[model samples]
Target: MPLQDNLSGYNSGGSDPSLFFLSGIPGLEAMHLWISIPFCSVFAVALLGNCTILYVIKTEPSLHKPMYYFLAMLAVIDLVVSATTIPKSLSIFWLNSREINFTACLVQMFFIHTFLSMETAVLLAMAFDRYVAICNPLRYTTILTNSMIAKIGLVAFARSFLLVVPLPFLLRRMPFCQSHVISHCFCEHMAVVTLACADTRFNNIYGIFVTLFIVGLDLTFITVSYVKILRTVFSLASKEQQLKAFGTCISHLCAILIFYTPVVLFAIIYRFGHQVAPHIHILLANFYLLFPPMMNPIVYGVETKEIRYRVHLLFQGKSF
Candidate 1:
């Protein structure tokens, strides 16, 4: 009897799958070529965009401020996040290489979750930068100094690593009795978690705990920072000043929505949407990971005047 996957309706050859199989898109394999076009295009754009932001920030003296520092960090993170899954996803689509070893899958699981958490923390840090720059202009530089930025980066990586490193170990100890096919593009945490036959309550609980702890807590602080920023902007004496103050936040606001909205929706649906068609869940899961990396550089580069000016200068044969 062919095995049926609850989430994706994917079928497996054997009752006990030795290697995890990755799907490009469930029920849409015939369109893999067409799908690969967009995925590849986005991947290229993400790489080029992030690299441009990093290069421009690195070479431009004026972009050495805390906000640009945070943006550079974001560019690096977006590059990693996009790299972790997109290549393999494209491989699955283009070369028909859908199999992934358990060890390899766990590695993918670790990087994707950990780096995304780092991105979240970096976003929060950026929000704080905005908050201080708007609310306490004189103190912005003194507060978010180079050393402070380095420390914030350190904490973001450390916290994400410590919290998420255990997840792969937890999954490793579990035995798989059902089809080990991950119905999504990459080895998504919950998608892999659902394959284990043994008790996964601990894994499930811990995953949720980490997600809430990192995402929930960071989003809260970012919200508070933004609210304060809004108050400061609105209190500016002139309408032009208020608009200018508020304009600086547009990129970050877009980033917050582009990143978090899909994440929260995906997390909720994965946990509780028993009735959801697997394709929708899988698409939402892919959206959260893919969309942000492709959008972040575009968002920041277009919104931040200094970066845009430098980019134009670079194109016009201007050095540095």
Candidate 2:
């Protein structure tokens, strides 16, 4: 049998609840029911929360502005991310030694990359929206028309699809002659690529370059955009307008901080932090990917009055 076939249900060590997928979820901690329960709970919350955001934006005309248009895109990306990782995680908690075929792993990896790519693009779009609104108020309408926004969304999805399409092909060509045990919970690009017994210098280099190009470049632009936004907000005619703009940005800022902080930490841990504590690396990975999706909608609902009110009305019927 090929190495992939051999690894169908292979456990690196004796079946410990922590190391093996107890039910069927990969990298799930079956022994630590406490941890698994919380992870599942938050995963459900993020899925539902992002879904609700999409529903509300689709239904409500008031939220059809450029800002909310970008927000709706963000909601879709978060939903994809949550959906992609959560089931595999839950399977580990519920089913012991669950098997995922090589094809299935490739599919999961594709979605992970696609959603992450879209997220980076949406963040950039949001930054541009704010820049136009605050910095060039007169042309905001002209620049961010409905057709234009739709084109932006299309471009983002196309970019994600094109970039991630080659990943599975690369994986298929590589020879995994030895270990099939993946270190990370999910079929992360780096984690999976590292498992190949043959040299993966080209794959690793391409992966690193792509990550830096997407995440690093996006972050740099976002920072520059925010700096310009701050300058514009400060120059506003009234304190009230400035405060409102600041309030509008708070949720986006919070999302950026949560999203980026873990990414940087993960890079450090995956590279240097590995020597110190293995569990620390795992814990950081979980937090970095899982926590932001769970908290993003909650933060937006609290900071954006429209979303908060709509969500409240959704739960509390009409009479009140």
* Candidate 1 lDDT tens digits, 148-253: 9999999999999999999999988887765667788999888889888788899989998998899889999998998899889989999999999999999999
lDDT of each: 0.88, 0.77
Estimate, for each residue in 132-163, the C-alpha lDDT of model 2 and write its tens digit: 88788899999999999999999989988887
Off by over 4 Å in 1: 1-18
TM-scores, all candidates, are: 0.93, 0.88
C-alpha RMSD by candidate, in order: 3.1, 4.7
Off by over 4 Å in 2: 1-32
Highest lDDT, which number?
1
lDDT of 1 at 190: 86
